[model samples]
Target: MDSSDTPSPIAEPLPYAEVTDPTYAEVAAQNFTVEEVAPDTHVLRGTCPRCNAVLEVPLVGNVFHGMRSIRDVLRKRHTKPSAGDRVEPVICTCEDAHPNRPEGRSGCGAYWTLLLTTEAK
Candidate 1:
């Protein structure tokens, strides 16, 4: 094919998009690995499916770190996972400054639920 006939390659990084698609989260979970960092804390390390930035989630006792600490404090409520607790929610808290991110939020606005397996925890 002629050079001019080929599609132009992208010249810039994709702009940040604020999305909460479950599919993105599902893809992310596939890349995550859970490790017990402490007796009471387990951390999930992986890359963000939406932005491809490294991200970490810590499960301290019954709490997942960084994901909802601020909101729980502001609301004056502490919610715990229900019995069995087979699934935990996760959000991208990647450090890269993605363009168009909201004023007070972090990550690329992607969120998803992570399954807690017996071997992973």
Candidate 2:
């Protein structure tokens, strides 16, 4: 118990006009969904599948084929995005919008991948 002896509760702040603000076609109509977190690594939770524009809080997304998409469920993969040894790919996409990553990079302009499996840990 080292977090200030724990036990802190203070909540109640999400009432922004009945909290109704989810567009982008209702979050691309819920697509792209994966979660393996270990055994190789995997964490693709619907949306951002290429310019659908990051959505979080239900409802997923799936644009054409150029924003980010990687769902390699097994077969030993790692083009980089997780499980260390960063090489690039994790829904990567700044669209080569150039600015040199790292400095608070949340996505590059190209390269992508992040849902590989097949135990490498």
Candidate 3:
């Protein structure tokens, strides 16, 4: 198997920038992948569609009910609607240093909400 032949998750690297936009959330929804690390616990992993930096947001508690209110999701849910799915706000917490990024802050300064689903154990 040739590693070079494998497709990268991020097609191109984007320079870090400190900004937040709802459009980025739409792109992020497509980029993120969900992984169940434990019972009722999951992690949303993906690359920032804005800055192309890696991101991971942990989710705990009831996936559908206790995560966030539907009203909040509606406000932050910039992406297409997914019926019966829970929306969780995700922020870029990547450790990579970006130029001009504020001190004490991590990642490229991007945040978005992702539609998450739960499966019976």
Candidate 4:
């Protein structure tokens, strides 16, 4: 069989600047809150309350609920998240004492991170 017979793998499109660019710091500046809906599960749904922008983090299966940072949410949202997805906090850049703030706005510019958990499929 000719190797060319098979189609090339498709590359996924990158998320919007608001989702990927570190320079776009508004998302970090925005206010949000996390809510627990069940044991070992959570529904992170909030907006940049200051800007009225919609922010959502939905855990599907075996994932556990815990504190997470803005960057973590952005990373998962841009990547492939499925059932048993574990999310947690590693660092943050938000000025409001958020867990994910790494640069902390004044230092290297605002950035955040979230801890992720998931079960093997």
The number of the candidate with the highest lDDT is: 3
Superposed model 1: Cα runs more than 4 Å off = 1-11, 62-83, 119-121
Best by TM-score: 1
Question: Of models 1 and 2, which has the larger lDDT?
Answer: 1
Number of clashing residue pairs, candidate 4: 22
Q: What is the C-alpha lDDT of each candidate?
A: 0.62, 0.35, 0.64, 0.41
Model 3, span 1-121: residue lDDT tens:
6999898785444446766786776676566666667787867667887777777778777644333322244453545655556656777888876777777888877776665543344
The runs of at least 3 residues in candidate 2 whose Cα sits more than 4 Å from the true structure, single-residue gaps closed, are: 1-21, 39-42, 45-50, 53-104, 107-121
Model 2 scores worst on lDDT over the 10 consecutive residues at 13-22
Ten consecutive residues with minimal summed lDDT in candidate 4? 90-99
**lDDT of each residue in 1-121, candidate 4, tens digit only:** 6998989997542222222344333354334445567765665554432223355555544445444544444455545656555434322222332323334241112224443443233
Deviation of model 1 at 56, angstroms: 0.8
> If scored against the real structure, what TM-score would every candidate get?
0.63, 0.23, 0.62, 0.31
What are the per-model numbers of colliding residue pairs?
0, 9, 0, 22
**Candidate 1: RMSD to truth:** 9.0
